[model samples]
Target chain A: MSESETTTRAIQVPILTRVEGEGALHVRLRGNEIEQVQLKIYEPPRFFEALLRGKPMDDVADITSRICGICPIAYQMTSVQALESIQGIAIDPEVARLRRLMYCGEWIESHVLHIHLLHAPDFFDCDSAIELAKRFPNEVKRGLKLKQIGNRLLEILGGRAIHPVNLAIGGYYRLPRHEELAALVADFEWGLQNSVDAAKWLKGLTFPEFEAPYEFVALSCPDRYAIETGEIASSGHTSIAVEDYEKFFYEVHVPHSTALQARKKPHDSTYFVGPLARIQLNYHTLTPIAKQTAEAIGIAPPCRNPHKSILARAVETVFAFEEGLAILKSLTMPSRSRVPYEVRAGEGVSATEAPRGLIFHRYRVDGQGKVEFAKIVPPTSQNQAQIEADLRQLLPQLIACDDAKIALDCERLIRTYDPCISCSTHFLNLHIERV
Target chain B: MSRVIRRVVIGIGSAHGQDAIGWRIVECLGRLGIDDVACEFARTPLEILDRCEGIDSLHLVDACIGPESGRLHQLQWPDERIVALRWTSTHGIDVPGALQLATELGMLPTSVTIWVMECEGNLIEGAWSSAWTQRIETAANRIARTKARAVRGEIFYRCDRTSGL
Candidate 1:
């Protein structure tokens, strides 16, 4: 071997910017060959699952909601559905519609926040949202306004915007008054138009040209785009009930991450989730305008480019706004907020589409309505392995650049996933070592 | 009618440990029932933008990690150091970034002041001690009585040396 080829080098990014939670990235290179790529999640493990044991099943929704500030509704919704299943409780159709509306609020706020503040900056080559705001003040303001409307919906329906207290096992604790819902109609209409414009604007941004043959995974619903609940579907031609989530997908501990990485069972292959995956798998179920927007932007299903996930997120934002407005216009205060049920011992599992991706929750309850076992697989953990795999595929293109350039490129690609490292036991400061 | 200055006091923090100082101050302001001043609580710095509309004057209180546990620091609007100091956040933008975004969106009030209480060590999940409570009360009282002083663009520290609960 030549002396240059025998040398070792490292590239490290000590802090990753523009994504959620705490995490760092490390890459090792031997000559021109990539040795390893690790998406390190060093945040101390939060024992939420362990804490749920022995708690009342009724309290599970509120407790699990504490897991992610951005998508508390996702956690709350999945947890309640799981518990409700255990009790053999079927919600009133009106109650279910309102629940879907509330989830739309979460998707709108979470997706808009990510599209504008978190991911857009990378495309613009800006260091932070502040920089992006200076360059595109109008766009940023519109995004913020849309996010605020979503938060208002949550405040009205779920209680406060963060860790909303209104959710219960069977249904909501209190129904929103018609007047309160009526007041938001004007803003929702404006948001629906604005999101379409935002998606068009996002389509103009220059995204990196990289596509992977990823196995896209998301929830598929027969009646509509899956947000609140559905069967698990993947691009690899696999469909399974939510109860069979464990049989299809499994988590394994990796040394570099505090969060367990998820992989497809049997083959142990990495699969993608979140906006890109959802959009590809559920395109037919998207709202009319959302479909129109996606088509207008020149992106369709089978878009494997991770960088264009921003476009997918923008399209979803449009769908969320339209869906929310329809529900708001027709929803009335239900006679009873929740259906009553008797507690009995049983086990149940549920999957729902969070803004980021599909989140899974399962619980085993005793006859006393106490939790016997609890499991939560957040979207970020499910995407961690896929993220690392993307990085590995991306490194060859970046290897020719300097260490700093390579680090920046890697960070940009990882941000495409919009991984809530905090939700995943998250991180990224990048270091590339060459030997 | 004379111009009615719409003044608002915003406390930014979570529910855990000394971090709750911001929330505590707002609670104290509410309990004191200071007239003509509105009090608000912000879980994160970004939420500050949501409460800034149509207000003429804004006062923001938050906790910071500095040299001392109970020392109080104050800075006025346009103070450049406010952005340089430890005021950013990992969740998104920092307090200063939100302030800037608010300014850009034309939502910032004409007069602004920021008060940061410095605490040392890891901020655990609980309430503060009696001495800290007394300090928070004193801060609340001071904010109620005084408007933004002429100390514009200055950082002043009110480090209390006396130690008793």
Candidate 2:
């Protein structure tokens, strides 16, 4: 087409009403070629890290947990672990088990919500969970019930579900008795079976046949699925210690986005995170039943489709319930709730798998235990550029369609990340201008 | 014998500043020694849903942005105005969305009431002023009186923000 024949078309979504936080999307097309796709996260920077400076290290977990409501446990766990590392406090074995158990509750709660209420509707072409519930009431109810079971576990262990108050720097402020945890056995047993059923149900959803050569990244534990703690691993790159994360992956400020987009070193390559990456990297470490459920449902490793992330999330939900059941059945009160630690000055870094993906936290504390410097890299920020890349790849498939369909397809693709834009500094209002 | 109604009042907020109106009012009602009513506080709509399974009457209290600050509005379920109320949720469903989901799944209480306090500034965080505290107390007393009337099976009419508390 000649320059004069080229016409500009702009498509804009003023506010992405679905998903968390506030964001907008802008796509520019020139003639038949796609020019630019920007996932513009317009939510103001929360300055959580800046606010942490000068606060006592004991206060980091509670302060960081406020970053994301859905995944507060992740924030609390990562921040607490980092501070504990700085102090060189060795937590008790039983406390470690309880921490893992608490993480299971988070995974189950966060993943199930995304699977049933958030992402599942896309597969069924419904506008919202209420619409999805109208057609799949049983599935939705099962999901909600499972989520309640997860939250119940949090309430039992963390003191409350949202920003659990139980976590201390080394361990917990208070520990629940064996009976309290034992009470969850029946619910978790129900949850395990229901999640298996839910995964099977989710597997039947038609996923788009779009796959990217993603650099799948997750924390890998030697003995079990990486949840509370693990070494960072990626499919396309060498494993690195949590402390070396900044050396490998770095963030950059783009003109259109308020959130900094992360890229791997050398070539600034974008990578994937969250459930799919975790499953891809740590498939062998999943619980016996969870592994069986995933294979039985045809969600094998090397699963590359982003749309099938819903499946990955479901399988992890099953793992969370199964893992939770084991912990409950073997429950015992720890001899001490928290380990004693002396005030010292040092820097510490730690990584843990949140329900969404790997979240890393680093803290430098003074001799008085006041935090002098703090850095938190949430999974959503790491996945932002990767999401934009996925949309770029996805647009060609949608380019032939009308602008509305193109925008909808892009949003559908983005929701698969279950991006806690609120945590990443979040929403997608889409504006596509075609020239 | 007439079956006793199981009523639950859930306060939804972060328990901070102006947002604490919901949890504070619920706390005030507890201090008032309201009889035979369950009082709970939640930060999310799903949390509210989790507490509603066995209840017969449900009341939700939260802070929202409206035309006037410190004004309390009592809107019943199925009311169109309740759907438009701006309640902040970082993730997942909002109040109206949660109610709609409950309705769809046949889990919403037959008697559902939403009590929202109008916030003056930022929706996520706020502090309670002396005036705000007074309003919270007044709202709690009014809610307590209303619940008492409901228990007695008296005719209770739908109330708007302009109506007497």
State which candidate has the highest lDDT: 2
Question: What digit string (tens of lDDT, one per residue) describes model 1 on residues A192-298?
Answer: 99999999998778878899999999999988999988899999966899999998999999999989899997899999999999999999999999999999996
**Fraction of native contacts (fnat) of each candidate:** 0.44, 0.56
**What is the per-residue lDDT of model 1 for residues B44-139, given as tens digits with 9 covering 90 to 100?**
677888889898778899988766776666777767777777554646667887898888777898778887777887767554678888988987
Model 1 / residue B116 / CA error / Å: 1.6
Interface DockQ of each model: 0.43, 0.53
Q: How many collisions between residues are there in candidate 2? A: 26
Work out the TM-score per prediction: 0.94, 0.96
Give the poorly placed runs of model 1, Cα more than 4 Å off.
Answer: A423-427, B66-69, B87-90, B120-130, B148-165
Q: For every model in order, what is the number of clashing pairs?
A: 25, 26
lDDT of each: 0.85, 0.86
lDDT (Cα, tens digit) per residue for candidate 2, span A1-435:
676238766776654555776788788877667688888887788889999999998888888988988899999999999999989998999999999999999999999999998899999989888999999999999999999998988988899988888999878999887888888899999999999999999766888889999999999988989998778899987788888889998889999887888899889999999999999999999999999988988787988999989989999999999998998888777899999989999999899999889888899999999999998899999999999898888887787798788878888888999988893323567898877
